[model samples]
Target: MIRAVAFDVGETLVRDDRYWTSWADWLGAPRHTVAALVGAVVAQGRDNADALKLIRPGIDIATQYAAREAAGRGEYLDESDLYEDVRPALAALYAQGVRVVIAGNQTARAGELLRALDLPADVIATSGEWGTAKPSAEFFARVVDAAQTEPGETLYVGDHPANDIVPARSAGLRTAHLRRGPWGYLWADTAEAAAADWRIDSLHDLTQIVSGAG
Candidate 1:
């Protein structure tokens, strides 16, 4: 039985594309351009946080664009809006008595982002806090330690195969793959095809998986 569940923050639990699209629009460039830039950065093997720093110069252009959009509409694009869409699923997991923790690579701004979105503080665990990244057995081990759960009793759900599935499984934790789109190292036309110990297409599907409803 799965007693605890861990999640990845960016694309798995939250809709990262929303923020990227917003940021792109603010920069007065096509969204795909920014997407390509990010892809290139990742291709270069720079971690997400470091890539952001390398690309900081381009951010001003986007910020200026967003400012103009806000002025024109007399409203602001708040990152908090994205959280509203995700909180219900998180709350549902909590209600199920599954100890939920976020195991991800993030920067110091992650706390600010979480607070801006009003996400629960008690459940978070990040590389920024832990000083390691996923796909490392040690990283998952740390999560297991933090949750006070054994490997067999824990499940880690994430979008990347290398970062989420392979490592979690290696560390002896059960795994679930959340298939959102064509984004990660893992590709499953549907969640069922992901070949994880369990598979889910949406956050709502998680309740049944965790509760053994299926």
Candidate 2:
């Protein structure tokens, strides 16, 4: 039985369309262009940050991020940014006394933004806080530590096959691949993605997996 459920923030609980659109606008690129780059990068099993570097090369990313936050433009995600299925599923799991952790590769302001959006989770953490990002053993270890459960009893749900499913499984956590976001949809039929304990179309499917209803 799974004792803890860890969710990836962007594209898993919250739809990041607005976030990416805003970033593209700020980067002086067309939103659709950024979107296509994102799809292409992930379809090749590459990291999103790599796509950003390829698109906006030679820019001081950390300084740019700092400037964005200082100018109050960084907090882009809103309550409505969440997928419709997220709340109900999280609430159901919370009601069942399962630990819910939001662990994602987000910026320093991610927790504040999440609180502002009122996303529910027993613990909210980011790769920045843990000093390691996903696809790294250290990152998943931190998530398991935050969940306070054995790796085998923790279920990691995310939209990225490479960043989420593969790494989580490698770290001994059960994996759920949600086929909605760029990486998720593009890699849905891949062998690595197929290895997920649950291949779901939405967060609503999680209730069944957690409760053993399927």
Candidate 3:
């Protein structure tokens, strides 16, 4: 049985339309252009941030990030950014006496915004705050540590197969691939995705998973 559930932020719990759209505007590129570039980069097995670099070669992402903030345009999150099933599903798990954690590749400020929402979770952590990011063994180690459970008894859920499923599985945790986002749908039919302990269309599906129906 799964004793704890840890969720990815973007495209898993939260839809990232706002993030890419804001980047397009800030980068002075067409929204569709940026979106297409993002897809292209991801398809090439390149990081999505490379799309921004493709828009402006030699762009220093960290510096540009600060510039965007100084210009009154920066990362922002609210209830509306979340997927519809996030609260109910997480709340149900928490009420069922399972530990709920939200851990993902996100900025420190994103972590603050997530906590501000006051979601029913035992912990909400970001790569920036932890000084490590996913696909790294250290990152998954921190995730299992935060869950306070044996790796096999913990579940790591995310839309990205490479970052979420593969690394988590390598770290000895059970994995769930969510087929709800772009990267998810793109690779859902692949063998890597099939290797996950479970494939879910929604967080609501997890209740049954933890209950042993999976």
Candidate 4:
């Protein structure tokens, strides 16, 4: 039985529109161009950060993150960035006596913003806070540890199969491949994503999944 549900932040609970838009605006490039490049990079199975490299070669992203903040254009998150299904679905899961978690490949600032939103969750963590990122066994182990549940009973959900489903499943956590973002729609039917214990298009679908598990 599924005892806990952990989610990926970007493009799973968050839509990522502002994320790409900020990068495009900062670089003085058209939004569509950058988005297309992002899709291309994901399609090629390269790191999503490769999209930024495709725009400006040899760019140091970490340095630029600091630069953006100094220029008053750093990472931002608010309720507006959340998807429609996020609050209601997470709350519902919480009310059903299931542990809800928000664990994703995000910076510490993003985690702070998420906490400020006060989403219904037992634990909210980020790769920056954990000092490890997904596609790593250690990260998912932390997720299971945070959930206070065994690996098999912890359900990790995310849009990126490579960062979400593949590694979580390898760590023995049941995975839900969310077909919500570019990487999600692009690779939903791939063999890697197909190995997920479940595939869902919306967070609302998880209520049924959890009930059925019981």
lDDT of each: 0.67, 0.85, 0.95, 0.92
Q: List model 2 lDDT by residue over 118-197, tens digit each.
A: 66688888887778888899999999999999999999999888889999999999999999877777779989889999
Tens-place lDDT per residue, model 4, 136-201, is: 999998999999999998999999988999899889999899998898999988998999988898
Writing each residue's lDDT as its tens digit, candidate 1 over 75-147 gives 2324554434357777887888888777776544464455465564246767767878776778999989876
RMSD versus native structure for model 4: 1.1
Best candidate, lDDT: 3
Sorted on lDDT, highest at the top, how do the candidates line up?
3, 4, 2, 1
In candidate 1 the C-alpha lDDT for residue 52 amounts to 40
* Per-residue lDDT of candidate 3, residues 1-214 (tens digit): 7999999999999999999999999989999999999999988889999999999999999999999889889999999999999999999999888899999999998999999999999999999999999999999999999999999999999999999999999999999999988899998998889999999998999999998886
Q: Which 10-residue window of candidate 4 scores lowest in summed lDDT?
A: 205-214
Task: Give Cα distance to truth, residue 31, candidate 1, Å.
Answer: 4.2
Q: Output the number of the TM-score-best candidate.
A: 3
Q: Model 4, residue 116: displacement in angstroms?
A: 0.9
lDDT score at residue 51, model 1, on the 0-100 scale: 32
So what's the TM-score on candidate 3? Answer: 0.98
